[model samples]
Target: MYHAIAQDIIKSIMADEYTTKLPTEKVLMQRFDASRNTIRKAIDVVFRHGLLRRVQGSGNFIIKQPANSGTILNLSIGFDRAAMVEGGPLVSQVVTFDKVQADDRLAGQGNIAVGTELYRVIRLRYLKGTLYDLEESYFPRTVVPFLSTDSVQHSIFAFLREAYDIYGSTTENYVHQVRLNDERAALIGVPVGDKTMCLDAINYLANGDVFNFSQTFFVYPDLELYYHTENIDLQK
Candidate 1:
């Protein structure tokens, strides 16, 4: 319920529903028919997104409009690839790990050659004892020659860095909102057709070779994401 309220409040803010400050807690509680705590929780979620600033005497004030691109300085809000090993009680359950050949489509996505050998891995992540997201990843066998259940149950990146001395140089991310399919929805304990987020990523090694391609589906309200951007003037 708080997630839904937070989503609505974010949408309203992006739509410019409020000019400077949000409604009082009493007003939001009455409008949402929720308790004061629930409303406060929802507001806190928004605040974490770098969208609002709470003034002690004043109400929640708009700090920045989230829809404005290239305006956010920094907002490191959600769990990401780096969070896997950053250590805050994260658990990973490996569902499937198999050696597979990359087909044309898979090759294109990973920027690898067709017929390339790859390790296809599917994992479910639990954050603080709750199902958080599902990740499907592929690693080129040439880059990652061996993988084990034990290694995957922890951090694959950490293993690569320690064992192979392979470090990530860059990553490209494509993110969008998506509705989960029946299988994914069931696996993540969400209703069918529930809205969530899909992040498609291509990761490169320090040697400038593509090493990993992955797609992750994040459960709503369980995940928060923030990106910092800066504007560059080409004519300057």
Candidate 2:
């Protein structure tokens, strides 16, 4: 019932010219002929999905649709599963490809020794032609060999899975608020010191082998991040 009402509201918003502010609870109740509980549930659905944001003083306002950005992380599922779902135009451009000795941070994340050879792959991502994120990834040399510049033009995960049957089953992710420094800002085409969100992820294969360590910076002004999580019953 609430889902039906929510769909109708979404349809109405899409069909309208002006930005659609959600009506008051009373008005929505009247229109949908729903109880207060039903209307509230319907609103919660859209809010959780990033369609709406509520201001303390102002009523609920529609969050402008993300230009073409789609949620990139699904905590409850693997990356391969999520990629198969319908979504936006996701694209990647290789920025840097080189071999370097791992430092303390890189070694720690990859569970490798310091000074071990590591393949560094940097990429810029676009969503529907809009620059969305800048990512830097490090892989232990023992895991991937002869990684060429052209290999990063497509999905790294795809390449790894197809070539070596390697895929991440577990990931440790950390998110932090950061200010982009000059070099990073320039790479992402944003002004220096721009507010950004940084994500550091270390991914492990089913065998508990650390395969990839990555840091991604998202320029906040032009890009948005959406994260979703679901609790799964592990007892089964």
Give the Cα lDDT of each candidate: 0.73, 0.68
Candidate of highest lDDT:
1
RMSD of each: 14.3, 11.5
lDDT of 2 by residue, 12-110 (tens): 554442275788889999988999999998887655544566877777787554456444433222333214112433577887888899888778766
**For model 1, how does the per-residue alpha-carbon lDDT over 62-128 read when each residue is reduced to its tens digit?**
8653453322212222312533222244588888989999999998888899999999999998765
Stretches off by above 4 angstroms in model 1 are 1-87, 220-222, 230-236
Cα TM-score of candidate 2: 0.61
lDDT of 1 at 87: 24
Alpha-carbon runs more than 4 Å astray in model 2: 1-86, 109-111, 220-236
After the best TM-score superposition of candidate 2, give how far the Cα of residue 18 lies from its true spot, in angstroms: 32
State the displacement of the C-alpha of residue 121, model 1, in Å, after optimal TM-score superposition.
1.3
